[model samples]
Target: MVLKNILHHRFFENFLKYRYLLTELVKRDIKVRYRRSVLGIFWSFLEPLLFMIVLTIIFSTLFSRSIENYPVFLLSGRLVFMYFSQSTNGAMRSIKMNSPILKKLYVPKYIYTIALTLSALVTFLLSLIVLVMVMLATGAPFTPYIALFIVPTVLLTVFNIGVGLILATINVFFRDMEHLYGVFLTLLMYSSAIFFPPDVIPVDFQWILTWNPVYAMISLTRDLFLYGQMFDTFTLIFATISAIASLVIGLVLFYKYQDKFILHV
Candidate 1:
């Protein structure tokens, strides 16, 4: 019942009404991001490729014997983490940066954040192609399990939008939130099993990975794409619930404070 009410809310109605506008905004964001760049869209493909090289070199030297298909494992986590980090960070600045558009037109505020996030999603998808190429280059098998890749990809996208909403809302009031978030992302990256396996971390502190949303996301993707491991129902449920909860709370908070945004920005 409560969910039905939320679905019919005025804000959501306006969001749907302005759906075309949102699409335009997303297109503009992508074009603007690569506006003057020489490489343009190819930069998206290059970023993950470069990171895969650097991380593979450093981590492989440390744990290559212990971990098979280390490059595939590292690249999968790196690309997903980069998507979340980049999406939230871009959405964080969307409102303030586009204050002119907000002030001039009376559109749903959430559209900006949504557009920014979708733009990042586009880039993330592009970067994922690099991961696929690396997997082939490294002779990783294409098992039937690989078909399940969409499950975690969709979950992670939802998680990114949720986190983006929260960050965009907070950054409106406190600009320093992005700076703090950057530092936090650094900690998250190192601790989330991006380059190293969880076993390397002290067993006592491994719970960090156990409870981490991003780690769960990365691990799930790796399990399907690289390891051919069976899915863990508990982990899937936990991660899905976390993503939905974040989206709901974020939407509620953003809706509550949305009216006040124009005044501040």
Candidate 2:
């Protein structure tokens, strides 16, 4: 009953009461991200476009014939992965970075992490336009299945928020976590099958991809956009469960540790 009440208070009541603060924080983060940059918001559209172009050139030369519609395949996965990477990295520093404001105010601590995640989500949605254009330009077939992209997208968002919360909480205690996570994200990016197809991976070692949540999301995105095929039911179920579990764990950790964050920060 204690745990249930805590969950309701932190996850439901606080969120509803502070919804405006969350929105303002999210807006502040978005503005801070593009502040003083001449390109400003256009960078959101450009980053993914440029990344797709560069990777398409490099990977296509190597695997072009092997992978049909390589641009669509790459962009679909890359865009989502970029959002996850950026959101988590930003959230990891959200608490420490905002320590001044946190020190002065009584705001709920999770606001910083959630705001950072939403800011990244906004950028991810903007870049998705480029992904759709790449699909159309590459002549990838789109079906009504495309409408269901929301399923994986929602799952991925929840996963990112959970991961962000945990990272934010940890980084408050461990200053070195930021540098360590940067290296980890680089390794995760390559291992996620963003630049390569899973078939090329050894059958014996395929479970690595099979168990990876990020890869599951990428595969689902590819199926929805490029292949116009139904997503694997098992993968979908596993990803949803994994996302929910992460969110619950993250919330508990953050709730437990939030009071101590100011001292560490």
Candidate 3:
């Protein structure tokens, strides 16, 4: 009874009322992203492939022995990290970038950030085609476990939305957050073990990767896609908890500060 009531709540009703608007916003974001570019959407397929090729060329010899099918390993991790970086960055800037619309009309503010993340997700899904091509070219095994890749993808999306909300709210108040987040992302990319093998790090530092939610998602992808096995129990649990916590905190903060957004923007 309680669950049914919650499902029919006014908030959900409002969301449904604005569903069309959300769809349009997502389409606009994707279109804007590829506007004036020659290759356009194909870049989604090519960008990650090019990145994988360059990174593999440079690091293949270094970790080739330690990591089997180094290209597949590299590409899998890279895709996850790329999605995370792009989605969060887009979400962070969604508010200010659309300030004109926000000021002119009354719409759900969260819709802007959600639209950015969803647009990024669309590109990320399309990029997975490149990952498939690389896997086939490299002769990486295709296993049933690959179907479970959705688990981490969904979790990561939730986590992105949560973080996006927090960043969008803060970004409205502090324009400097955009610059600071760029530096933070650089540090995060290094710490994520994207280009390097985590095993190379000392045992003492293993905790760093273990505790990182983004690394957890990346490692989960590698496990399913490259290793042909189930993800670690701890990783799944940690990722779920981290994602939920982020969303809860983000909602709390976003709603609390959302009214003030009009003042700043």
lDDT of each: 0.87, 0.89, 0.91
Specify the highest-lDDT model's number: 3
| Model 2: residue 137 alpha-carbon error in angstroms | 1.5
Which candidate has the highest TM-score of all? 3
Question: What is model 2's C-alpha RMSD?
Answer: 2.0
The TM-score between candidate 1 and the true structure equals: 0.95
Model 2 lowest lDDT segment of ten? 5-14
Candidate 1 runs further than 4 Å off: 1-7
Candidate 2 vs candidate 3, TM-score winner: 3
How far does residue 111 in candidate 3 sit from its true spot (Å)? Answer: 0.5
Write candidate 2's Cα lDDT for 124-234 as tens digits.
888889988888788888799999988988998899999999999999999999999999998888778898977878899789888888888888888898889999999
* Candidate 3 TM-score over all chains jointly: 0.98
TM-score of each: 0.95, 0.95, 0.98
lDDT of 1: 0.87
lDDT of 3 by residue, 171-259 (tens): 99999999999999999999899989998879988998999999999999999988999989999999999999988888789989988
**How far in Å is the alpha carbon of 72 misplaced in model 1?**
0.3
lDDT of 1 by residue, 62-143 (tens): 8887789998988899888988898888988988989987889888888899898888888887888888899899999888
